[model samples]
Target: MIRKLFLIASLLAPLPAGAEPLANKLFAAEKSPSTQESMPIGTYAKGCAAGNVELPETGPTWQAMRLSRNRNFGQPTLVQFLEDLSVTATKIGWKGLYIGDMGQPRGGPMNSGHASHQIGLDADIWMLKPASLTLSRKEREKISSVAVRSADQRSVTKYYSPQHAALLKAAASDPRVDRIFVAAAVKIAMCKTAKASDTKWLQKIRPIYGHDTHFHVRLKCPAGASLCQTQKPSVSDLSKGGNGCDETLAYWVSDAYLNPPKPKPSKKPAKPRPPVKSARTYVLADLPSQCAAVLSSR
Candidate 1:
């Protein structure tokens, strides 16, 4: 009976492990107000945040989903950006925006969900606009957003619309946003639809994996945040302020998309792979040195 109860409880929890470390648990469970001085430390994929703020669950034109995850947290700038972007989206014929995960309360590697939202600058906005801005807590928890891509992962489905492109453009146009990640099909659609004058914002819209259901927004390292690490821009990144439609979009639709080459077979039998470690198993040493201080602080 005890074993069955344990199994039932585990299924209800989102974390991969039954128990986490002291420091990991502390940072994960914090729900206090953000510190006055916002500081981001390290790159998006591997970093931590200080003075994180929580986005209100319900806003005038937006509602945050997945409240159980406790991930609706980020720097002050990120929270403000979402609120402002949602209002912008409403003005352009979009119903409203449904926000997904932002970052942890303190912003670090989470036990699950994402590898990049470790910094407070990253946020995920569901592609499916809510029917109403005021979603109840129960509805937010039960509702699931539909993916924009088809099963083959090659193109956008019927769920996509011109308003989707407008919504993305509005977010990209913000000076605070560094880049946005969407599925290849979404990027292709935007390239074909956006006006030439709006192509500059489209350049910041990058193609990444598993973004058909929602788009990922990354903010620039805020000024005065000296400790924050910025990602090195690729040489082809809007080179001389040119549009990205020619080469990058073409690659997603080429033969590489339909038939990828099989890996070369090894002559010797494959060795047994080692067991993977879950995020909960990670110790203080696995994280950046500065993260310890961030976790220990109020």
Candidate 2:
């Protein structure tokens, strides 16, 4: 009994020294859903989930990787969307999606590798779909996702196939999906090949950086989420213009992008880099006021 008591106390202890408050230590300490009321607190980059559900590690058409990160938790809507998308992938001649991070158990900033997803409305779905869906947890951790970016890093490589466009089309078909971030090359490829009937779905596929291995999906804020904040109109609007493959894409392929300017050599010694604050570091006051109540609830 004393040993068990010691373990509990240790788990509740404050974070080690010099850690950034942006990746709030409290988020790592939370292991259970805070409430049954499904609501998001703020924007995807600055938010928390009041109630979250865990996506099972493996499903009929998909498998969640990096289980050790414990980021398989998300709002119920997000979880359902992923499961449904997995079925869509299977229908389009691919095995199924290999899922990446969703959000932390409490749905806040992470220690690393993402700027959004703090609100549980965002998910990263790997382009690599395992031929089989029965991979063990060990395999899930060891299997590396292949990068579909071309050697030049401006376009999709040979590994990217027509099936990828089909997959993205399926994901964007859902009205709930607000935006899907992919590389410039992928967007261009879709613009060139998408049929007339399918061009509208292309509007939701925005070109972004470093999504060679996975595409991020963000959902529209669910109905009746009063405290939930919506992103600016530009982000949510997909009908502003044609598929973004005109002069805008040229920027990604320009020398400025292909060969970025290096920093001028500093005369003085460089100052020490400051600590990075992740979503996990956000304190209750740093987030929506209601998040405090969410964190403290069951």
List ranges where model 2 is wrong by over 4 Å: 1-23, 235-240, 262-281
Off by over 4 Å in 1: 1-26, 33-36, 235-241, 268-282
Candidate 1 lDDT by residue in tens digits, 120-162: 9999999896788877888899998989977777789999998
Candidate 1, overall lDDT?
0.80
Candidate 1 colliding pairs: none
- Weakest 10 consecutive residues of candidate 2 by summed lDDT: 232-241
Model 2 lDDT at residue 171: 89
TM-score of each: 0.84, 0.85
Question: For candidate 2, lDDT tens digit of each residue in 169-232?
Answer: 8888799898899887888888889886657777788888888889999998999988778876
